[model samples]
Target chain A: MLADQQFLRIPGPSPIPPSVQLAMGKPMIGHRDQQAKSLIKQLSPKLKPIFGTEEDVIILTASGTAALEMAVVNTVAPGDEVLVLVTGAFGDRFVKICQAYGIKVHRLDTPWGEAINPQLVEAYIKQNPSLKGVFATYCETSTGVLNPVKELAAVVQQFSNALFIVDGVSCIGAVPVKMDAWGIDILVTGSQKAFMLPAGLAFVAASKRAWNRMESNSTPRFYLDLLRYRNSMQNDTTPFTPALSLLFGLEQVLRLFETEGMENVFTRHKLMMQMIREAFKAHHIELLTPEDAASPTVTAVKPTDFQVEALRQTLKKEFQLTIAGGQQQLKNQIFRIGHMGYCSPADVLQTISVIEVALVRIGKQLELGKGVEAAQRIYLS
Target chain B: MLADQQFLRIPGPSPIPPSVQLAMGKPMIGHRDQQAKSLIKQLSPKLKPIFGTEEDVIILTASGTAALEMAVVNTVAPGDEVLVLVTGAFGDRFVKICQAYGIKVHRLDTPWGEAINPQLVEAYIKQNPSLKGVFATYCETSTGVLNPVKELAAVVQQFSNALFIVDGVSCIGAVPVKMDAWGIDILVTGSQKAFMLPAGLAFVAASKRAWNRMESNSTPRFYLDLLRYRNSMQNDTTPFTPALSLLFGLEQVLRLFETEGMENVFTRHKLMMQMIREAFKAHHIELLTPEDAASPTVTAVKPTDFQVEALRQTLKKEFQLTIAGGQQQLKNQIFRIGHMGYCSPADVLQTISVIEVALVRIGKQLELGKGVEAAQRIYLS
Candidate 1:
């Protein structure tokens, strides 16, 4: 039975490298020790280069959602209006968080499988000049569409006072977003995605502009407050006890990212995306997002006359392949393949082979080896 | 040059066991997958026996402080009166968090090395009938004092509306905390301390009565919100991406605890504490906390004439031992020796040997081989 368990084929927690795992296995250190303070201080500078921003980055002992909440509560006060572009599920979550906090939200909703037009976002901002912040996802994990954050940032940059916060949770290391150069104020990322670690901690880079806004904002924040983090980071320690094991894992993973220049890392992600796209084309499957808007991380494929649910179930049951399904109403209509951290050409080939086999079992018309052959060609030549 | 890193000897992250380290290296699984859902569902029931509570225990991908915020914000509202019994730094932090949220705090401050008098605590509660919550720490890691939570909870029980919240971050699995039997309402623990894993996740158990208070509370909580955790726990998932690696480690560690019976775990901790106390006493050093109030997790020792800072530094330089220093004004006044987590009687002996060397270096009168001999008498016999 495929039930004995196989490798993780989902985007993350990606198959951890043996070295990273070994380092994580190292005995824990006290969070307040001088040795830990030295590690944390050294870590902040190393992360600054990956973020491409000179701003201070704070690591929190929570997931990406906690980091996102830190930005939202810090930049936008209780009564302020925030413009969120909902191109996927993560974007919709930003709206939900805002509503939960009693903040006025202006949603710029696009179709689930498409990217939002930057001009429309700019127009909305112009209409609502009093907007305190604009929120967008760099790579919408749900639809596998990359929002035009660089262009959107330009529109919000003109306001100067309004903050541009991007949820780079899924895109930070795999893609490039020059935080200061693009006028982005707050950028939040999680370790599970591109950073190639198990999901736990979130990294945030806040500009002085965002901190200025946080000075006057009061929504009763204690745990998610960025000011406390900013203050504690100066002393080279967290305000509270941190998840030491995950931090240990992250330190090694980030070191690997540094060893391989960030540009090379992004280039590798793009290559993986190109290889997947070529294989999908060979299989006669339609990709959800347009070529220019497609993310370099995950790809969503619309099903043909094939029974998508049966094919997905067969892959899991027979081949032990774990892929993602569309969320909400799109579930079962599309299956997504992830190519983020710790993924390689072999992983892609194996996934494609399983998909072809599952499709054949479900009575779908497909050449058995076409997708794998196409992916191999891209990998080798 | 003592440049290369040595093992961490502070309280936590206590050196992780080899088995626990290997457990963390496993690949990730989608939190929503049936397999993952089943794993989480299984994990919850296993935690109930360890927590000594019939109530549901919620897991958060955060440090110990995050769990504290979850219990505080969820149970106490604005303008609510909270009676905080402070014995050390962590207890002081609880008061600071309460004040930050505009909650009226009545601080019953005891000396750093002294435990709270249950009679005084009860008298204060009787004096302030409007108190909504009573906050205390089970083991004050900063000063090595263990407050009598059961006796204090008895007093808080007299006030029907007052909820008992305990920060068992440093003491949980290493000591006995009977949640239901002791009438504790909200109990929180961190993964790094006593659990013998690296820090990154917090485990919180809330009573049904505490959840009822949350339903009517008007605190602005989203990430640290217990309501969201309670809602999602019903389905065996968290509202956000949890630190999956830490969870993997936690799952294995909890199983280990169950295999060795909870009572056995408590006995081991008590034995280690007794060994440490005896070793220090043989060296003619005094423990900072009273004998009856000493925490089973860590021991705070005060030297007769040596500067605590110099002795601590010398131990690190000469021997690779890492002990904690006094907090705030207590700095250089005392050095803390932690004997929790993966520590054993042997580990305690090694630490005592280092302390003995440091004491001799400081020209204190001490017989050769006295400390180790005393520890062996308590442990080996």
Candidate 2:
């Protein structure tokens, strides 16, 4: 293996494409310069289709967690009740943010590897008549589960008027999210995921109703305030200094998105996910997430027959492929493979072949080409 | 000028060094990967001397404004009183953050072009012994005034038990801070300023006394919570995803600091400031800041000789160099030249030469090379 050629296959940050790297390496510009403002002006409209919303996507120079906090703080106040649908770690993040802000949280936790049921969400809304907001995750990176946001939104709207906010950190650009049509009040994502850039910038889009709610929010906030973001967006400037290098990479990433077409990008991610899932099945591995609920960006495998840590170590030591082990409660129980952003089906095939090699090295009894053959068949078909 | 050789001479985002830019372009790694953990471990120790503190500098993936908010929410809560020594726009940022958090702010507004006097802080502390914190800016970026922080800290400690938090966003690494020695409870800075990197990461260091106060504070916060950052630092990880590209740049930046030596770095900044200030005097232009209180990182020029906008426009259109215009109330009133981070006396001389050319173009009468000669004298002497 080349000295610096490791395959980073975590939910995020995804690998930086060569062009994006060069874009990020471009010389820094003044945050207030016209060139910078023009970059923002161009990025605003270009970013909308990815979230599938006409609302101005406010770019924040913060991690995905900060974006989640911004979403919560802008929409709700202390003493207001909110329901958080805990699909996995990221969903739990919303709960923590709400509790931190003194918002009364009612949690609906699904099984670790399963998405929240829509009917259950409606039932929770029925029970809690005064919930100010409902929070969820689009793709739980920890469990590799893709929640049915559209169906969930429909059920939520039918039962109550709580603002529907989704954390789409792992799957926003890789999957189709119709924020307006599906009635998502706020959608948040980060650059390091399917946006194919480094971590720094978080993109958040809020519906008109959410903004209306935020106008009256009394929570203590300064930097994470969405109204400040909105006011600055009107002038094509950031409320504070932005990460210019990442914004440069974002321009290139958006260009790439436009070239590939959003639909094709989603299709590519879907294909990669399917290939990896099928490969795991061929190797007699159980998936953490149900196949129907599998994330298009990441796959979590629970190897019942062998040690998950051993396989991950072998992959790293021999193949230079770094995949994520389980987080929090799922630690040491499963391994996750990320196939989002600049990743492809061909990349998935290579990963499968490498996994096959590492599996045998880890004392797993397996037919040599079984997994690779399964993945190839899926890719070609 | 070459196609992309524009000089960014703003308070921030400052011009990035070429090596730092390339380092930032390094391949993305998983946030949980050992490589990333090791990177954090290496960065943590290397960063301390810049703040002149043995205390761990918590790096947050957000702008400087977020860092200020983090500082405020960590040590104080709603209904708590604080004294904000408003030197300029950035000092006002602390007041805004305090007000946003429902903290009662007693403002001590210095004249825009002048630094806060230490006596004023002692007077405020005497009157408001119930103050939970005292906020001050080390270098007011807008008016280019460097407040006497060491004296201010001494006065605050002598008179009050309130936490002394300083915003050093525009001038931390470029100058001698001596945070621990000076008894500062908290010192905050950002990446794009004296750190010689892109705008994203914010560095904050706190005293033991500040941590103790935070333990008793009842502020509701999550993403900007310093305790979470402190907890994650023990394991060499971030509470949230870090700006990985910028961290990579930070590695290179640390190496640069090691090679140059921190004392030399401060002296370089000092010399650059003197050179630029002398150059401005040679042109008979008035400075916004007093000679002793002028910031080493940035210099604001209040010119009665020519139009500020015309000179700035000429610099951009003819020379491809960007000097910052005034911010907020100072907007269109003064032109500011940034001379921090990767900047040198030679760069300042070049800037002086460009300003001379632009001045001639913008209907100003001047002897050519006079400003450049003045800067050269200061550099050689």
Candidate 3:
């Protein structure tokens, strides 16, 4: 059902801007060349404001999971006790990665579709005084819950021994994350999410404390080694041959962000999320996350009278709007609409209109244009 | 100096063809869609003949070094004895990766710019009867030496317990490597080299014996896990979200190879290597690799009268030809000419002409048109 004019409404790998694509299509350059070094120099400073950090950001040629793995390997060694605050699938994956490295994980489990409580995390930290680090997710893409990362970081800071690592893979750009202001130790993101690029490059920013931990950590790592990255970054390049095309795309993406102004970018995503949420409410649909915990990047809605899979297929086949379904345990119960990168007000209206028509065709007994009108109200306001 | 019209002649990231670039610029698709599955299906079979293997080839969204790491993590656990045949920098990297994973490595050290002796590897295998795996490189990109993979595979097969892993990152497509016929257990390659695509995707093919060893190995690995790939491959997709744009580029690259005919592709590379070598000889330049062990993909020539770095700079600044300098210990000692992937007879001629002009400009005593005439002779013959 994919075509030239199709709307990609997935949680990650949002629609790439034309400029980004054009930049990626440019001629290839050797990674160690002066041109590549200039690219690294151009992109490194530009990424700091987006991550809200003054520390050095490392660019890795890998997916988001790889960045998370790098964070784990670099900060904590084997037999180190870490706290994994699990809100959704991504947080569970963080637990899995730590467990794979022989790190003892104390899992703080919250139910699916809910955000982790900062008070509970604080209580756990107070009880477990020897915790080496704590892993949390800024936005749980699987359930569309954006956790209270600022409050959590504050709680972790109250106890200075435990480093705070945030998996900001899905919300770093679209949502406002002040990594330094919130005392986040290590924040990780990927190119596919809000970066408007293909899925290859991963960005990780570490504070002075995280770097100190990495200096003495005895984890056996080679390819995902952060110390090597720190060394190569001094020369304005990566330790390995970088994914050059993606880096090219990233330069244009960062330029686009700067031109648009980061504040406006975040505001636009918040407006899109508002429009989608209002449209869902107008149709009498139930959202998976509470209104306070909903992510600004994606919205998950539970299908009441219609099968989620059938509705998803109808939207894709009929309207050419490709959205995401629920993951893991949430599958078949909910469908998600993504309005992250490269999304505009017009895209939101069109997406809502298509969904309304699809729901009507599937005998959901919803009046046509109700969703669109609700979304247009947000746009007008 | 990396302008739009400049020629990129790096050893790994060889020039990308226009068709591949055009394919990469197509509208993005979700990695979990049917289109992505079809892409996997299309590319999997096409890659087999190129790798000269009939086994299951796993596509990973990482650098070639990650694929080498995957081979190590999947087959050998901690305390497992492995033999690494070091011919150049890439072979030394293999040894480092194994050591990082806590594998006991018995290194067979060969001098730089030289090929590993199969007899020495055979002797090491005979002495280390309990070796779990043996790692080697097909073409050492660092030294431009093409090891005798077929003969080495034969030697490794004689010791049936050890899995033979080949780093074919820079040589698989340009040279003739029959993975099955040569009894190679694991062959790894990257997308940037002879695939005529950007650097991101890596392909690793494993024979049944290697798979058997991987099933019982206890090394802790998550992201580079091969079993996850094997499971997802049943549905013709990757376990993780793949680098979609690179895969799009790969489809076109595979078609280009098919259109050119695989044998003709190999012959074309052989002809380019011959042209460059003959040109080097006519200019009285000294080559780093012995004539018999030279790679058909790259030529590493030691500077005689001219400094290697100075010559490389002249070629870049004056001729817009981006060649490679030596890596690691060979730095500033040798310059390499890459003729892999989209390189053609005309490209070879242009490169040779430019090198001849640069050598003359650098105060080296070389007759005008001599190198081009030697290359033309090889091209016409």
For model 2, residues B1-381, the per-residue Cα lDDT tens digits are 212236788888887766787788787999999999999998988888889899999999999999999999999999999999998888888989999989999999999999788887787789889998999999999999999999999999889989999999999988998999999999999999988898899999999999888888899999998989999999999999999999999998888888778888888888889989998898899999889999889999999878888988987875568999988888888999999888765466557766776787677887655666566557656
**DockQ (0 to 1) for model 3:** 0.01
After superposition, candidate 3 runs with Cα above 4 Å error: A1-3, B1-381
Error of 2 at B270 (Å): 0.6
RMSD of each: 25.4, 25.9, 25.7
Interface RMSD list for the candidates? 23.2, 24.0, 23.9
Docking class of 3: incorrect
lDDT of 1 by residue, A1-381 (tens): 201234455555565655677777778899999988988888888888778789888898898998888889888877888899899889998998999899999899999889889888878888888888899999999889988888888989985357999999988888988888888899999988788788888999987788888898888899888889889999999998988888888788877786667787787788778878887898788888888998888888887787667877777765556778888867878888888877654455546655665676777776554665566456545
Per-residue lDDT tens digits for candidate 3, residues A1-381, read 111235788898887876788899788998889999999987888889888999988899999999999999999999999999999889999999999999999999999899999999999999999999999999999999999999999999996489999999998888898889999999999999888889999999999999998999999999999889989989898899999999999988887887778898888889889989998898889999998999999999987789998888887765557899999899998998888888765567657766765776666777555565566557546
Worst 10 residues of 1 chain B by lDDT: B1-10
Q: DockQ (C-alpha) of model 2? A: 0.01
Which candidate would rank higher by lDDT, 1 or 3?
3
lDDT per residue (tens digit) for residues B1-381 in model 1: 111223466767777765677788788888777766776777778778778899888888898988888888999988999999999899998998998899999999998899999998877888888889999999999999988999988878975469999999999988888899888999999989889889898899988889898999999999998889878989988899888878888778887787667787788788878988887887678889888999888888877677888887877775556888888867888888887877654456556655665666766766644665566557535
With candidate 2 superimposed using the best TM-score fit, by how many Å does residue A173's alpha carbon deviate from the native?
43
